[model samples]
Target: MTDLLARHRAVLPSWMPLYYAEPIEIVSGSGRRVTDAAGRIYLDFFGGVLTTMVGYDVPEVREAVERQLRSGVAHTSTLYLIRQQVELAEKIARVSGIPDARVFFTNSGTEANEAALLVATNYRRSNQVLAVRNSYHGRSYAAMGVTGNRGWSASTLNPLNVSYLHSGDRLRGLFRHLSDADHIEAAAEDLREVLATQTAGEVACLIAEPIQGVGGFVHAPDGLFAALHKVLDERGILFISDEVQTGWGRTGDHFWGYQAHGVTPDLLTFAKGIGNGFALAGVVGRAEVLDSVEAVSFSTFGGNPISTAAGNAVLDYVLEHDLQANARRVGAILRDGLRAAAGRYPIVAEVRGRGLMLAVEFVRPGTVEPDPAVTTRVFEECRARGLLVGKGGLYGNAVRMGPPLTLTEDEAREGLEILVASIATVSAGEAVACGVSA
Candidate 1:
């Protein structure tokens, strides 16, 4: 499978997204490319859903893991102090903007989110969390309870008290066509009204993804969150920033996605890119929220020596080499190339996102209705040409790509050429199918 499946035991557990009729089994990778079982090498733009962050076969990460493995012991429980875990936690705290931050390691983003929810609910004495429309947090019942994207949500039987808001998605929502300032004001008013009418004034927290990942990379205008937070702040409702896809400078302009806005979240959850393919995730929150729990807490596998070692190496590589700046420079080039290509096709609805985290949505030629058929063709065409991208968004009409932050200028152009050509091919095919001249 190419694409990761979601929210069920019967479905193939979400691995890599598979758009091809015959799914390719990726056996190995180097740099920004992967090799399938058939020995077909292809440029990997999706980065295993943006998890293989620093590229394949990075020596620093490999060597760090090897050193930790050779240390003669690996499974010491969190009962004992682990030097690597402590060191990595210290580094993360420094990078995390949370004041007096306390870190709790988890094996994945879902667990990190669960931990954040636990702390927030405990501290605020409530389970009522405000979630934005089209937001995705995780797959656990607790996590899924707060999730707003119906595409990934499986059941409505939830334990947490969550209310949906219309502030996250701008492209398809009521305020999409409005100007930035007007959109901000309108959405903020909606939030204020929802708070006044929906639940008691003392809500637990508002959990959000700065850029909705599974919901098609949708985000509101700048300052929209700042305005929404003002209402939350007035009621003492905490804010949880889910940076699972938008953290670690993947968005180019900022290290954390929330940084793009002017305010800081009371708590934050992160995963996907921190370990560069290694299983590492955690929650960073203010001391009061974290220390509020009276019970002794520990995760047997979270922050295990091996994962933390890889995390240290990955963080070092990102900072020492300045890959964030690289993402900005190369992302601009990719966006420009995509914008120019979009001008040539009528089926392309929009090309949106920041830095390497970009998406292209497809729609019927003459209407706003999503065209998943054309989107599938474009995805398949890119694969036929040995370019591996991603397929996502609510209606499955958006193609997603986030090449490794280390992608070179030439590689960016190469992927862009293949992507644009695939769209051209698909668009022409659709044109001919409709009895129109291409």
Candidate 2:
């Protein structure tokens, strides 16, 4: 290992996951490509965990942030009025689809979700929350409590009582054999049962990710959440859409993933791609719901002028360039290419995800068993070939790709070619060791 890697191991927590057998240090990036410490250029399919929405080294975002830095003001606590913060909030509220929307900004997705939970429990006067199976919200105590994926959840202790409901993952669920419509009905029924038997019938809210990010980009059938919304509406439970990964037009089909389900959530949390790598996240909801917090609350560095300036620029670029439509067009191309590769590779058990956030699942040939060993080998193979991707799943057997929404057709094709070749190399048992040491 490099000296830096050794130092990282010595200082960072052991549970913090690192990619590659030999972790690489990225030095710089432009567009969808990044250069590592060794000066090797690789196509960045992971997009810094889907945070670099407009791509790295975007001039617009850079200029905005630089301008903010040049200004005499930097840290204005939430107590003071900030113009950039107000402008970004107005833009977010307008696009959020919530009637009479109000926004509360936070420094990260975890904090944003925590604030949402605070508002929700306080508003409903209940500490009971409903979450989806195989979902990941954030890393805070409250966020991790609602997370269903065992690999990501670090503890069993929780601040609130959380009940897991069946989400739209039809592959391994109890209703896997049922039709799509039937599966939705079954999941909705399962949710109703949970609400009836698991809680006091007055739950705070239901938190969900339209597409499970850390769960390998797993998404439910369309309209699944809408169906469950009916149940929550009747019970007076709020709906919190965790769009940390699915927001900012990454899904291609809709600007917001919840739009695909045809439901307007009572609360929505956004991060990862909004500020184009800056620490910017927030909760948007109806004015009344946001105003339910009786105590005076403030975020020290949330919605800072610099970050808000970057957000405004990012939003402006997204609108002017129509990156959402680009995501749809290029995402369809990449998805088709991956599906074609799945047809050719026996180890590729399934290809899933919408728009740019996509995943390829690795399994034993002709069987449904997850093959994490082969998945690791394939990951190293891709790394050796100068292609960087991501990995996630309950079993750690899925390869995830969420390239920048600004990814071009040619770049998508090139990256797909490299991915398919890497998979082929690993499947043929011709892959070399990736220098992993214990």
Candidate 3:
């Protein structure tokens, strides 16, 4: 393990800081758990950042990939379609309900989002895009332009055609800023106001995460998405939902996060759980929007045999095992456990999320100020106790927990107990005191 780290440091590029991790070197992983090089097993609450939905190194997926590997991995462009790719695309479209949705595959979330942006731009023939503040799309040139994370320099990277507004405010402002005062109507007026500012037949796309996973797991307000769709209808603009984190049944009740809002996006992109841990992603769009950009779309390695196999296997495992329903049940248990823990500790600020995508926010006692130190302590203590969770949010003060949907109820309870003990210790500014010691 030491040799592996040394070799990586000696040969790898310097951009490694882009990914966040602790000092431990993970050696292998399996159902709801990962083993480090030191032979210590850690319960994984973050689930490969919510990617390994069915759990790590799933045998069925591995077998499918091995079978595909015997033939070939990469295919010759979309020039020759494989049966698996076609079958997978059809399955995704049928599940997504985008009306004859066409699939444009990619290798990562950013590329999926990039493809969605291109479809939106070409279909509308407009350059301007609207996105919410703190929203994270991806870290590509165009995708980053629409991302609202202040740390990533998206604002300075591409200054034009990208407007930042609060999540709810983005939709509301877009309605009100585009039209005159008399035409404006309550909160819905903001959308009209912004759309009016763009040139006639302009404003290409409006992209947002169904649940802002990276941006604090912030759920869009009820009725807000449907209202946004109505405004988009009025202006003939495209609506894109970036489902990289919230897709593939991690959100509990629905397979796709947007389904929770009872709204369908003109363009939707997916990654993460589609391939479980393998490199796979895709952009699916309404037939009308997709057909408009059909000629312009092409990728060398997208939808290759191996990736398609992994994706199909993941879908099969998720459905066969009823992981979505498990996510709902386990998520409720986890949330209830966290709330109970919070009641026993005053430093806990709030707990928010749905299904398996949950977060426990920490704040300084007696004030609402974010407590990053407390969060760090909680994370470190959990890691020391053989449980691995993640931290995120604009303030870096929320303990993010999105374990694999395959997590057993017993395992989930054990992890929660460790977390509760850690939080209690951290919030009190001391370690647990054994009764025998005193």
TM-score of each: 0.95, 0.97, 0.89
- Compute the lDDT of residue 434 as modeled in candidate 2: 34
> Tens digit of lDDT per residue, candidate 1, span 228-302?
899888888999999999988888998888988888888999898888888899999999988887787779999
RMSD of each: 2.9, 3.2, 5.0
Best by TM-score: 2
lDDT of 1 at 6: 33
Off by more than 4 A, model 2: 430-438
The ten-residue window of minimal lDDT in model 1 covers: 1-10
Q: Write one digit per residue (lDDT tens) for candidate 2, span 196-313.
A: 7888847999999999998988888899889999999888999999999999888998989999998999999998799899999999999999999999898999999989999999
lDDT (Cα) of model 2: 0.90
Q: What tens digits encode model 3's per-residue C-alpha lDDT throughout 305-347?
A: 8889999999988889988899888888888999987877767
